[model samples]
Target chain A: MELTGAEIVCESLLKEGADVVFGLPGGAVLPLYGALSVYPAIRHILVRHEQAAAMAADGYSRATGKVGVCIATSGPGATNMVTGIAAAQMDSVAVVAITGQVPRPAIGSDAFQETDVTGVTLPITKHNMLVMDVKDVAQAIHDAFHIARTGRPGPVLVDIPRDVLLGDKTEFVWPSEPKLPGYKIPTVAPEAQVAAAADLINQAERPIIMSGHGVLISHAYGLMTDLAEKAQIPVITTLLGISAIPSSHELNLGMSGMHGMAYANLAIDEADLIIGLGMRFDDRVTGRISAFAPNAKFIHVDIDASEVDKNIKATVGMVGDLKAVLGQLLPKVEANVHIDWLQHINELKAQHPSHLVRESDELLPQYVLQRLTEVTQGRGIVVTGVGMHQMWAAQHCRFTEPNTFITSGGLGTMGFEVPAALGAQVGRPDVTVWSIAGDGGFQMTMCDIATAVEAHADVKFAILNNNSLGLVHQLQELFFDKEYIASQYTANPDFVKIAEAYGIRGIRVTRKDQVLDAVQQAMETAGPVIVDFMVKEDEGLYPFIPSGQSVKEMLEEPTLKEIT
Target chain B: MVQSNHTEQHTLIALVEDKPGVLTRVASMFRRRGFNIASLAVGNSEQPGLSRMTFVVNGDDHTVSQVAKQLDKLIDVIEVSDITNKSTVTRELALIKVKTNQMTRGEIIQIVNLFRANIIDVGSESMVIEITGEEDKINALHNLLSSFGVIEMLRTGLVAMVRGQTNGLANGHSEQVNSSSNS
Candidate 1:
């Protein structure tokens, strides 16, 4: 079948099963957008900012495990997507960002809207290509999707020159198979590593399983839970590893790190055999590398080999798909009782419990999260921006399924929740979608409200307007001698008015009594709705152990008795 | 997770038809599959057309062999070989600028002379030292120079080639055929 290069691009996308693309049109991308008109099956979302388009795609990919697609024009459009692409790379989200570039001849001459987007995005993307030849367009798109969707998935940019889009391409041959030499997906877990891991699990007196985002990405949650339960091992999660095991599970010890649960951190410190699953020991988790579980014999399992010894030393390092490694080790692992370890963990949990007391007039963020969790029954998708709100959501919101809760864990990118929620809603329209963002982070991508309004995406955004960078302010108050620096942002916009500007339903909740009613009203609305909850500015997240410190060293709750 | 201490080193150089993501795919392969790469370097080759990549990695002999075999399977890669012990010429270049005042200048000069490194650029307060050798040699120099205050350091990671009268491209074809037949 003979098709133009632009048609071939769209056709290849359809072939790869892309249901939607987030983008905006410009002179360079007119032909591709024109070609997209013919394909009614694929929905195209026009985001206000090119950055949001890339972020929306990232969110879509993270939620659905599909290649999230985004399109933008040349120059500024391409540059705008860099931050989003970098965020995806950092967190390992599968995304294919397609940008239209000037013709081949004008690439270096700085012609109208001309930019070497491939060069600009080189370091940020997993891989990138600039297509000058019409024949290579189809193959490039095919290869882009393949590269984006496979092993340690990340963003791949394909910059299509404007002239190439206008050219006539008759030979439309998608590569029968992607011939990437260095892209091998290791299918088997090394038997020796698996056996060694099983032996360590069997012999360990104080065993702790530290789960990370890789477990969810590899779909090893069930296997992990089974192993933890059967072996009677306590499980602690990284911020990204939340929902890997149900928060309600007895073995689940919530989160560990700077703002992690006291018990979780304590367990990690005291553990003799630390089995790290699908997680890189970032500074947040390890606090002080030298002092972090100094006595523990570490068993690190992750798909990324580079991460094995890059951080903490591992006694048993297995590099393969977490799902496969856990599968192989599951049967060989003997069922044993770590009753003493469990008792110690329980004691720690009792010592420091997350307690939030809502006043009669003050709208607490925890209450909103708890109510949302109740209404959703942990069945729908919940996304959050980076801040105190995110920690609250992670602590309070119970996610029962994989891919149900998406947040920027590695990069901790703020302004991620709204667009991510939009993408999640688009990907899974049948399920309820909730975006929880702090006042500070919410304003970063607040424009995405228009994206929701335009697509009529059924998403509910809960803006916890504490009127400050709550996380930073909390740290300053606790550790920085109460000197707020770059944490306070006064004179904020009326969120209700902003939502109204986007043609979406908006409500403001100042009192605790109005919190549930506002949320319920937003949920009942058919399309996108935003409920701005005026939370307490002085409110702080609790159970925060200073970084590099032991879990036992955490401040159980706010020191101010009045706030409590 | 079981940690295997048997860190087998293999040096692989691939001659690829210059294209994008050929490196990413290769790096992604090692990264995603958890192949321990000791050192990796990629740049334009002598051949007017192709790019050469050198990868120093630690894996089982079978796995390293499989990686070479797999490289041959890639359409863009012209050749790949484990050049760890194949009589290869290996070298690495590093430019390290040290922060030194009058007090530390004599000590820095002494360290540089002991390492047989050349001083590329000399400032009133600093000196840029150029050193080329194996990775360990560079590390040793870096360690000794750290006390004198290293202001900046840039290493052009290891680039290698077979020393004998043989080209990787020629051997690549036979291995490709052998692997295809084996498959």
Candidate 2:
């Protein structure tokens, strides 16, 4: 059928099962917006800033495990989306970002709203294409979705010139399948490697399973827990892998890394065998390579082969979908209980007990998160911004299910929660989405509160207001002799007032007694509600390993300091 | 002199689907990883709609293996083979223009004849000589011609194929694991 390049884009999105698109329109993307008006199948969320558009798309993908779509104009608009794109790339979220470029003839000439977006996004994206021809647009979109959702998922960009979007009528040819001859996705992992991993698990007296975000992407939550339970092994998770198993499970040791539960870090250090599923051992997770799990024999299972030995060595590396690998491995593993190991871990847990909220009249961030969990019945899909607030939310979450905990783990972008919550709310409309953010980060992307209102995205934003970049302030307090710089906010704005101006219900709570009530009100009322909790400014976070230090260097309290 | 973290050099052959900016993609991967390519040559392959690239990568065995693994991971690159250990015939072509007066012209011709090189073009003060062989032969010719006041030189980097009927790219990209010494 004859179609304009813009129409072909919509058609391709329809084919790819993409129903929501977070986007912002500008000069170059006018044709796309014009086409979008007529295409009612796709619901377009108009965000205030292009960064939110990309981030929201990333959030949507993380929440629903589908390829999220975002669109923007070229030049400044496209450049602004780079951070969000990088966030997705780092975490391996599947996002298809579309940007408008100048006309084909004006591409190299630096015309109005012109940008070499593909070039800029090349290294960050799983793949990218700049379609010079109108006929190539549909295929490009199809290929993008295919590439983004495949093994080791990541963001992909498709740049279409403005003239091409407004190109003359051309016959739209939808390919039967993605025309990628070179793209080879690994299916079933090598049987020998799977057997090898199983052999390690069966024989180990002290073993732990470290689950990563790949578990969620592969929908291996139940299988992962099954393997753990059958082997009677304790499971610890990467930050993004927080919800892979129910927090209350006997074998679930919770988040294990910097800012992880003390017992989990101790277990990783002492374990004889580590079966790593769908996770790369990032620097933050593995402090000092020389000292990280020195006694642990690693069996690394992931979808991407390159990540196997990129960090810590893998005695057995299985490159396949996590769920499939788990299915293959579950049968070979022998059922055994490491009673002594579990008892030793319990001793560590008692010694460094994951610090709980103490008696305080002042509203603590950890207390705020605990109340949120209690009030929401632990069902709220919590999207967190970076800082002390994020760690509290992660530590306090009663994750009964996977895909409920979404945050910027890889890039650690501060202003992530607000837009990401809107995206998550959009992705899963039936559930209540909570954007639990620290005040310092909340202000950076608060403009998107308008987008949340307009889109009717029902997200509850709980602002943990400490009047400063609490994490940075804590770092400065520990390392720089309390000589703070650029971290503390001299005059922070009234977040509730900002919310009220945007025509959303705003509640301010500074006392511990008011947290549950505010959380309840936000969850119940719900088009979009903002609750700014004035938390205790000096509340210390524990179980922190200084940068590049090993798990052995983990500090149980904030007493450790460096003169530098 | 080319500096590398690893002393050994490896030759790798990659078969990639011809696409725009694909060369940039491959080059960008090397640049970002801090890998130095000693030599590279790309041209259309025997297979239609595909391009064959021969790369002389300078690194240790593990680093070169990683380089090959990373290349195979690229969506455009279909296959990558470490042809360093294989029995292969390599060729490189170089064109040299040297300053030559009437007195030095015959001497230049004599030297070119000794190397079985052709004098492709002759001008009043310069002559362009064409030589095709392995990299060492071309380098030797260029060094010898440099004493006659070489004006310009261009070299097509290394290209190779297995000596017999075997294909250089074995399509065993997936089976190859990163052989890091530490790992």
lDDT of each: 0.81, 0.87
Per-model TM-score, in order, reads 0.81, 0.94
| C-alpha lDDT of candidate 2 relative to the true structure | 0.87
Q: What are the per-residue Cα lDDT tens digits for candidate 2 across A7-106? A: 9998889989999999999988889889999999999999999999999999999999999999999999999999999999999999999999888888
Per-residue C-alpha lDDT of model 1 across residues A1-564, encoded as one tens digit per residue: 888888888889989999899998898988999999999888999998888898889888877888899999999998888888888888888899999988777778979988778777766777788887898888888878887776667899999988798776677887776655434455556899889989999999999999998888888999999999999998888888888888678898888887777667777788899999989898888877777886699999977665776577678888788888898999999998888889877776666555333443566778878877877778888999898899888778887877888888777889989888898888888888999999898889988888888888898898888889999898898789999899888889998888888888889988867766777787788898888888877877876768667555667665323221
Q: Give me the runs in candidate 1 sitting further than 4 Å from their true place.
A: A355-361, A547-553, A559-564, B1-17, B20-51, B54-183
The digit string of per-residue lDDT tens for model 2 on B48-164 reads: 677899999988766786788789888888788999989999999999999999888888899999999999999999989999999889988988898999999999899988887
Clashing pairs in 1: A287-A548, A288-A548, A305-B34, A316-B2, A316-B3, A317-B2, A317-B3
Give the residue spans of candidate 2 off by over 4 A: A558-564, B1-6, B99-111, B123-125, B145-149, B172-183
CAPRI band for model 1: incorrect
Minimum summed lDDT over a 10-residue window in model 1 chain A is located at A555-564
